[model samples]
Target: MSVWDELVGQEPVVQTLQRAVEDAASMTHAWLFTGPPGSGRSNAALSFAAALQCEEGGCGHCRSCTTARAGSHPDITVIRTDGLSIGTDVAREYVRKAALRPALGRRQVLVVEDADRLTDQAANALLKAVEEPSAYTVWMLCAPAMEDVIVTIRSRCRPVLLRTPSAEAIAGLLVERDGVEPELAGAMAAASQGHIGRARGLARDPQARERRRRILALPAGLGTLGDCLAAAQSIHEEAGERSAAIADAADERELDDLKQSWGVEERGRRPTGYAGSLSSLEKDQKRRRTRLTRDAIDGVLLDLLSFCRDVVVAQQAPRAALVNADVAESVRSAAGVWTVESTVARIDAIVEARESLTANAAPLLVLERMMMEFLPR
Candidate 1:
């Protein structure tokens, strides 16, 4: 029920944050929390903010804890970005707000969920506030890594780095916190590869687990060039579907706003310029969709690589559970078919796929090449 309870598999972080809140020895007005996706970087920052602002130092049952966790607290301001980047204009507004006195709590706390997305101007705008924040202001920025934030801003902030927790730790949280069955929680935790969010999703959604099942089954099918192409196509299709699902709601809202601007009702017919503008908008949406799909596929590729790594680890170090424990049989079969050197090469291919996608190479091209490279000699 406490805000700390929601942060699964982060006991060390929780302890540190609690100590800081208890002793009032938290350094620097600004804080940077870095962790991989699903590691709860933003969640930790906000929880720490709540704890700091709470008169009782994060009394789990207090009004401050409840409001802070629900994102309705007066003294805590959280900014989450849906767009590609957070520009300078918004950064300045946050900085100005940080200078103000607390409205309800001991400190005015600001949490930026995607500080890495801050543009150059945005980083600069934030620099001054971080350098000389108000006595009552506490700023927390969350990102994937410390290097992603500007060094100038980073140097001025206290840093919190979260490691990926073990499967046992993640499973324990799911059972104790979410009231999930112990066995099912362990399975999902194993499959999540230390990502608490993905573990929860796989635990809650049978379909997501099924998707992972289908994907893990793919290595057995990559027997020919045609099969590799088919595999690549399936990945592309799935990613497209995932991205379209994300973009559909936002796209509809944008179209509605355009109609309102043109003084037209929802069902009203539009004129020539409207159609042309819509076409351009659709084109932009398509590009964004493609980008998202490619990103999703790249994530899959990374997971696949993790499976291979687990196989290597299992053979070389049998004490550890495979990173792809969900695909243990598949990994065993793969390990049988290939030598350790070949498995390493395949991992290299996965890295190449990631690089290609990030560098804006065509998705199909990168995946196709990766599949070919992964094929047994």
Candidate 2:
């Protein structure tokens, strides 16, 4: 299995990068990889990095390829952040590392997996490094869309766009790579609506599948105001739970690091600046928790949008293959109840909710407003 094999449904991108790897002249010093969530933008960037380091151009069995893929290569540095923003300090550190010569590989590779999350200061710091990179250095930045990156930074890098894989392609990969049964794989692919990671999760985890099922069932259950409010509360609670789980471990780790930095024991005298440091850490934790909560809620909104989209499609073209095909009957029923305009309105409501969440609106309140919009008159 070569490195390219893991990048499902990106044959054209693979070919282009493979050519670049074989011909150094075709390779650029900086690259921007843009794709939707679960479309493997980061995977593509990392695969290219591995190929650049490998003597045989990403031969999966090679030592360089294995180490790069495992994220242990001496000359490869990947930055991924769990927080809301990547600060100037981290970006400067990456820039400093990028100036060094390769320790083991032929070229040093720097990858930023969440370039979209870089603060303005951080982006500026990175921009300088990208503008005048070392001869043997390469930078790869991945984001959800080209527009997510600053225009100045984006214009300097070669852009690689990855499309969402087709359902057939996603299902095939699930069967081939993950050993999922074909029947289950197809269902998951349809449910995931071209998200490869989401399909894999749904296929492998019964809990994930059940959660999706409940979410998908929501559209058909908004028959009354009471039902709509109940649905909203349920989704809000689910988002809270998911966000807490995602942030709790990271929060604990940050607290531990702060404690170690202050040389403070469980019941010891407080050191100088300890209170200030603890306050700063708490502020960062709060920001992270808020961001995680919004992200979790946004995921639920996207799923709701997909379901609404299927209803609109069913209304317009009754014979079309729906994304949520398992719920075809419910979708058809929804199409009957909601005119095309109303279905579109529901989608708009979901988008508005997402925007509100990004604006730091209360999550439960935003969800409640959206659910009320879904209620029948």
Candidate 3:
């Protein structure tokens, strides 16, 4: 297996990067990888980074390939933010870091996995570094699409686009790598609608599958204003609770690690700098929690969109396969209750909810409004 093996269904992308590796003339200081969520654009960027660092062009068994993929290579840095945005402060710091020479590898590689989240200021801060990197420095940025990246930043980088993986491709990966049953893998792949990450989650996590089922069932039960309102609240609160649970667990672990480092306990004497360090970590954790909460809500919105789209497919193209095939009865019921126009409107409403949530609207209010939009037409 090569470093590119994990990039399922991206043969064209793999070919481009491999040729670049063989021909230095095809390589550049900066590259932008664009695709939809779960298209593995980030994975492509990372594999490309490993290939660049690998002496034999990314033989998966090489130390260079292994360390780079595991994020342990001294010369490679991955900027991944779980928060809402990659702020100017962090971007500037990384720009300075990237200016340094490689210590132990062929090049100094920096991969920004969520370049689309860069604030305008952050993008501007990165522009000069990307435009004129040090010799052997490479910048690979991944985003959902070219438009998601700022024009100035994107214009300076080579564009590598990844197509959404087909269900057949995703199912094949699940069977090959994850050891999932072929039948179950196909079902999850179709349900995830080309989202490899979601497909994995659906196949591995019973909770994820259950949550999807609940989201798909919303349409048939949302018959009244009260029902819609309640659904909105239910989804909002559930997402919040789920995010909080994850954050709490992570925070607890960090807190323990910090205390161990400082040699202090909750009831013991505080170290000289422990209080300030704790405060800083708490602030950072708060940002992460906010981002996670938004992410959870966004996921629910996507599932709802998929269900509505399935209903539309049932109405207009009766022979087309539905994403939520396991919930065919729910999809058929929704198709019967709503006209094609109404289903399209519901889809539009879900899109609006996504946009509103991104704009920092109150989650409960946005979900409530979106749920009411699904009320009987």
Candidate 4:
């Protein structure tokens, strides 16, 4: 077995890192791994960190490799966020950790999984750490694109870009790793458009598959203005429910932890400044909820866009395979009715709505505009 086994369809990236592990001259103190969603950027970073610590250069069975991959390695620090941003405090804390020597491994490795979420102050704090690192320390930053990272930080790191894996590769992984039936695995791979996480989700979760079916049905149902508004409201409500499902329990637990830390009981008298701390925690939770909500809405937009792409393909090439092949009937119907230009315009509108959501635009309004524009012309 190899440490790179799980990193499917990224041979070029594997080769680059392997050479660095073998030859010191090819190694760099800082590395950047950039890829689209589900391209396995963080997995690559973790694998590289494991290889650097391994005596046999990432023998998959070694303790070092297993520990690193499981995120239990003493010398590896993974900086990821569930909140909206990584602030200066977190950045500085990791920087201080990064200065220490390897506890038991060959090198100290710090992997920043969401480099794009770093605020300006946080980025500045990291610049010095990446610019002049300890001889035995390495920094790996992962982001969606090279440009997503701040210029000053990325400039100091070696670049490795990962591409979307092919449907064949994704399907093979699903079958081999998760024991998904081969036929369902192939279908989920195509549906996910090389998004490995999404492919697995669709394969393992019947509800996710059902939710996708409903989202794909939207274009066909948008025949009137009321339909459009209703669709937008439905999408917004679903986003709220889904985000709340993920956040509600965690929010309550966090509040409980905070209260306990302040020595305040559920029905006890208030402690001094407890209100301020509670307010801060609530604000953070709200920000996280907002991020989760937008993420949920964006997933809907992406599904719609994928359906639009299939429509474009169907119109352009009548015999081509669609990404959403499970809904071939709908794809063909839409393709037969809508002109290529009209379909393309709606694709543009959905993409714009995704961007608007990322920019903190109102979800209902952005989605309403998007749904309205998607009406058949």
**Counted clashes in each candidate structure:** 0, 0, 0, 0
Find the candidate with the highest lDDT and give its number: 4
Candidate 2: list runs displaced more than 4 Å.
none
lDDT by residue for model 1 over 33-68, one digit each (tens)? Answer: 999887889889988988887778877789888888
In angstroms, how far off is 70's CA in candidate 1?
Answer: 1.6
2 versus 3: better TM-score goes to:
2
Sort by TM-score, best first.
Answer: 4, 2, 3, 1
Q: What is the lDDT of residue 208 in candidate 4?
A: 98
Which ranges in model 4 have alpha carbons more than 4 Å from their true place?
267-274
C-alpha TM-scores of all predictions: 0.88, 0.95, 0.90, 0.95
Per-residue lDDT of model 3, residues 37-61, tens digit only: 8999888988998899888999988
lDDT of 3 at 127: 95
lDDT against the true structure, each candidate: 0.83, 0.89, 0.90, 0.94
lDDT tens digits by residue: candidate 2, 242-264? 88998899889889988998899
Model 2 TM-score relative to the real fold: 0.95
Error of 1 at 25 (Å): 3.8
